[model samples]
Target: MSAPESAPPTRPPAPELRGAPSPRLHNEDLAPRRDAAPWRTWDLFCWWMSAWHSLGSYTFAIGLLVLGLTGWQVVVALVLGIAVLLWGCNLTGVAGQRAGVPFPVFARLSFGVFGANVPALLRAVVGVAWYGIQTYLASLAVMTMTLKVWPASQSLTAPQFLGMSALGWICFLVLWTLQLAVLHRGMEAVRKLSDVAGPVLWIAIAALAVWVLARAGWSVDWNYREGPALDTAGTVSAIVSGAFLTVAFLAGPMLNFADFSRNSPDARSIRRGNGLGLLVNGTAFVLVSVVIALASAEVHGQAVTDPVELVQDIDSVTLLLLATVSIAGSAVGINIILNFVSPAYDFANVAPSRISFRTGGVITAVVALVVMPWRLYSSPVMVNYFIGGVGALIGPVFGIVVADYYLLRRGRIDVDDLYSDSPTGRYWYRRGTNPNAIAALLVAGTITLLVAFLPALSALAAYSWLVGTVIGGGAYLLAERVHPSGSLLPEPAAVPAQLPTQR
Candidate 1:
């Protein structure tokens, strides 16, 4: 459905309460929506489909299979893990739909106006990291195709810069520019691209799977028995770890889900979309990955975890070119939807008056380049320690937001106070900071990080997201009970209702 006509813009409160126009808490970009959200339930489903059907997600599925679980066991883990993720997404999605605000703005309800920046910046930094990593991954496909068509291009590998070959840098920059172009067109362009890309990539993947099966035969082993065999107890632990990793894989998007959810017209749409996108679509994709991996091992004498490599094995240049393009397109689709958009909104929220959405996105792109994520991608140790650690931190913020919205506030948010700096404003706590929330985040995040990084505690690292979320949420509940933040408390029964705008 078309969005309704934009309502007349509402001005921020007077300077006495809102301070100078220079530091105004709310701006047009961050404000409650004046027009109806246009996204339907199917749009949300396609959104997840686009996000999930990436080389990185496929690699992650391969990682789960490598854990020695049977195909059915892996499916069980994925279903359970996705259900947990869906629950979290639905909770935040409801809040976003009801408030008609982005994730960072919605954070103000719990984190206070100024304090909201903490979580916003944390999430933004993570996005920048993932953005670079994904861009690098996408570029690899271009590099592979380049070398395939022009073997002479292989000479570009001499004297590598920042651990990347000249050809790799060329491909990375090319894909990076392409992503920026798409992002510049804004959300409508993104929605349209996702709607097309998801289905196209699905067809490509299905074709590849069928070809692999036809060549390798259907007798491929479905169990991961090539490595050391695990006993029943070990097998069960591996399955559970597979489930935990599934949640970790999508943890970043799940936290900033409000970015998309706010654009959704209703909570039911978000729920239905997540169910199909994550549960059903995710399962089917996992099955395809398993079939392709088993076939690759049977045909190539080794399991090809990387889809690009598997495609490179194809003798037909036409098929190889098509597969490479599909991987590149899928990478771009996911990187934009998951990595680029979150930080754009987040950095804009950092100083809405100073940073426009486009500028924030540009800033994110530059920072992604500065991180030189190719180095991170090259090292498995760095991947586990650094990228994994950052993902674990998201759990704490997620817990705090969910707890405050559902438990403390009981699903009621005062939209006006979310922008107000007045002492009387419900959300204006202690010069715009909520110490209680910050405390919970730090405590929970620190412990999770330790578990994720420390060698001695590595056994718990895989489940850090789950552990941190529970601890952070429980801590917030306890802290609020002892030192209540009246801002999030429910209003008196006699007070006139001014419910947050549904659209």
Candidate 2:
């Protein structure tokens, strides 16, 4: 291709928010795409599919059986969960798709230019932790497969250092380095890899389910728990709790969907992608996972949550190699989307002028290294309290942003002012922070934290994500309505027929 146009037209493009003047907030990566944003409905559908068909998601369905609900009941919850995710993604995504900015940049509308970093940092912390955990899990898959083939190689695991064996470090670093190499090539490479790996991972999952079912003589025990069944009220409660658990699993991605959706050509295309991807593909994955978990338990005496372990137990070198490769690829695929990319944009938003997207991603990787995710993942107290504590803190921010943009601002964004720290700029409310936004965030976050931790509220723990969103959103509406913030601009006479040009 020829070298790009010198710069965008002096008049900003329609169907986008572009051309911020401030150096403190403007950069090539964070700026609206001057070139075509080429992703379409198919691309987004593949993106969601790629994000879902991974080692983590495969295990997710099996773990829900601990809820003591039947397979079909679990399926219903999964559907509701994905539906909730779809609703959120569409609401948040249309803003980004139309505005042509990542979540952090667009969020300035609600959170203020500098205060936007509050949400960014919150999301980045979560993304970095999970990024490390997923990489470690993938490395374990590769190492386990190797040890299975060559029993003598078990010697490499003798010395434990920094909570991982020597062989474990080697595998982890190798996977880590390879993933960075792919990311270094940029998002296009990430997209291509997902397009290929996502379907391959699901296909392998289907094969695994078929093989396990055949081995079990085509019969499945719905009572996967090996205990007395839950009563009617308990069963009803479990289904509701299980549904929210599914939502929480995808909440990190759903919260900042604009990271991906900003590349879409139009908002309608995003809606199409979300509909097909989350509704159809998500349902299929949950149903298949349920079938596989049930059959595997009957055949192997326990439900196999980890696909890698199940393939290894089949005792075929060929199946082991295929499953291992697929798991590694799909795990990396989802990691980049779910855990890596959002944080990259988020960290860059902290100082767009100083940090490029690649630099931000490296920063995330460094933090992930220090997070020592294996330790984080292993400690029950840590997982239950620390992660949940931090998670509760962030959930309210999503609601705050959505409420500010769609309801308060009436879906209009002043593109140039998003970059302006100048007190006179339209978005420079109260020296670059919206106090009302902060109040709602704190009030709702505290309640969500209580629901997650207090034993008296244990029954409500599973619903924390939903609770945070609703309470946070409702609080914002009430706060802004009762005490009007004059910082908000009046809505336009009508929605613009074309994108408004930026100076």
Candidate 3:
């Protein structure tokens, strides 16, 4: 709270890369509490729970079931896909632990110190959109419960703007307001909420699954599709598509991974957290999801995507108890973690000095109302396009970061230099931009765009992440080789403003 210590003399301006902009030189000043870095293993496990236990998650799981794959095949896809996710999360976690920053800050190396804004803004926009959609859905749940308990409220329905009924608007606004309240409280509150929401959601889901099985006599016939799609021609395509979708779902969290990782004590904590969260925790979630899907077929004569609806079919009080808890908890956990946290951190990344965590969160809440997110989320094609488009960029950005850290930089970063505008500062390439990274991102992003929009290569659509990652990574590595920048720049004596006290 006292006057901050002054930074040392500025370094000489480094020669600029072609088309690079001049950077503003200064020291970064964001520092977090040191004690917050250490999280328990269970906390890490719950992170995945928060990520996976949501309405979208249930829809994806049920889609897999309807894909005609046998239960065993679905299990294989889920296991293999999540295992890959575990590895990606571990690497991301390590980056976060070392940097003590969020995803957008680390992106400075891949994009220019300023160029990072492109990807950061892209991710933040998506986060804001999701915030609106999730808030709307949560409101729907509340409205449904309200109307059920008080049938007289049904008369409140009336014409409204944007196709939403008056009651729907009320619910949406109420949920939107509540989300802002929680998000404005900061990450500590988000963490505690997720910790409770995650475990409670899983327990409720498991109970719902058990009740469904008991009601349906727990049949194991599976009734998998036995045609060409399942047998050979369409098989590989399905698995690949499923995997790519999973990656896209993960891209948002992966981008912001550093926000959480900076709180970790060491790389091992990151590794442990990711392993439990992505692999073990994810596997268990998929299993319960599939069981519910399978059992619902016998009870309803069709697959059910909404667990709440699935529970409503059951007459038992026990079934209702489980269903209400699972859906509600999952919604809250996901709303806070994925929708709230990502955008809040992103806003901070853009202007750490100007925006505290709470202000950034409120911005997200207001934007959610303006967008009418429910309409956006309801369109499957739009969702896929949005996810695929942004997701293609995720791999390239991640690749660039890994290259800058492990390969070009030799695992060393002058944390203070990240914020400095001086040419001589470690990261300030001409005008504060990293031209090679920008070029590579453009090239790799092109490949992703092609895969997404091209009709001829439908088979390759699901491999968008792989294509972008390989192309982007290989391109960056080649750029570095063709135009070496010597070893990483030296570390500074003065600590960066955002540097973690723990490390």
Candidate 4:
């Protein structure tokens, strides 16, 4: 494409397409160039696999099982939730596909050339919270296995530190260290590990579910809820709200999905990957989870949340071993991609030159150690609160980004100006702060957070993401009309012949 007349002055020696592609995105801050983008459809599938195939994920999936709802009700809620998640994932993917940049870098557009740091820091802080939570859950799986081996340790009389047994701490540190090793290697290793781990986890869960049902002499049913559980009828409201919860719970990571998508070679791969992974794969995983939870309830008189706990209840050594390896390994993969990779990019965004990938990763590791995650997972209320608080911010960002890309920029971006600091740069709005965008973000975030956290609005908890998305997107449109920026800065002059057409 030819540079527009309004584009910035052509630099001497013009922006010529360089002969060599950039080095792999291994410095820890950006997408590695070494690996080619996977098929878009595959990306979504991978996310779905990673999202639902974990210990914490199972807990949420089986939540409907014990909600006193009929089997059909449980299916209704789960399907609704998965659908919501798919929609949010789809929007998030588009931003990445268009920008060819990770989340933090993309923030440069909305937050301004220099003002992007705020959101980056906010996201990193949230990442810390999740890092601790997932780490703790992984340790729980380890503790479960250890208790089986040395039953006597279960009767320790001494008061333990941090509400955790000595064995728990050991396992936490072990798993924590393992995550650091894999994450330290950078994105390629994380991707390859996830591709393997997600599938392995699914297989193990399927195996465990089948074994449990066969042993219990029960058939899987989508209509097995006992009476009185299905009494909370009000179909219209229930279905809509149930669908909203699926997306709300997943809003946090979905907000910055570009962190992964930016590494892709194109948009099609991301769409395909997410569609298969998030929509299809997630629904299947949740179905298996519900079945297992129901079967376990029949056998033990209570629905199971933790996969390891379910495995223990069966008292089958072979099934237990399979569950242990699969769940633990899958947890490790998730920890690396979601928690570890994000903070590295976030921290780098904060101080690109000063903090290298490894240094930033170590910093996060220390913080995770200090938080002592196990205590947080001690209660369901705590997990929901933690999720609610972070999840609140997700909607506003999603709204703002979608509105900006589709309506304002129309999916076109100048690859060079993203790094330029010239006052004339297209993205340097209002002294490096896009007031309209910033205002929209704050307004949307406040509204959603209230919906999620306020006692009076507890009923709206599931719809928080939607509320924020609408508010943010609406606010931006209003602002753009009232206070729009001039056109996006034109592409830089002096185009190199070798520049790839896409990025």
Q: Number of clashes in model 2? A: 0
Among these predictions, the greatest TM-score belongs to 2
lDDT for model 1 comes to 0.80
lDDT of predicted model 2: 0.80
Task: Report how far residue 302 has shifted in candidate 1, in Å.
Answer: 3.6
lDDT of 2 by residue, 26-48 (tens): 67778764454356677778888
TM-score for all models, in order of appearance: 0.91, 0.92, 0.87, 0.86
Whose lDDT is higher: candidate 1's or candidate 3's? 1
* Candidates arranged by TM-score, highest first: 2, 1, 3, 4
- State residue 242's C-alpha deviation in candidate 2, in Å: 1.2
Clashes of each: 0, 0, 11, 27
Off by over 4 Å in 1: 1-23, 34-37, 489-503
RMSD of 3: 7.4
322-441: candidate 3 lDDT, tens digit per residue: 565466557767877877777776676677667767877877887777777778778888766884477567777776776666656655655555565567756667576778888888
Per-model CA lDDT versus the true structure: 0.80, 0.80, 0.68, 0.68
Question: What lDDT tens digits, residue by residue, belong to model 4 across residues 341-386?
Answer: 7777777766665777677788888887887666666667766676
Which runs of model 2 end up more than 4 angstroms from their true locations? 1-20, 223-226, 491-503
State residue 53's C-alpha deviation in candidate 3, in Å: 1.1
Clash count, predicted structure 1: 0
TM-score of 4: 0.86
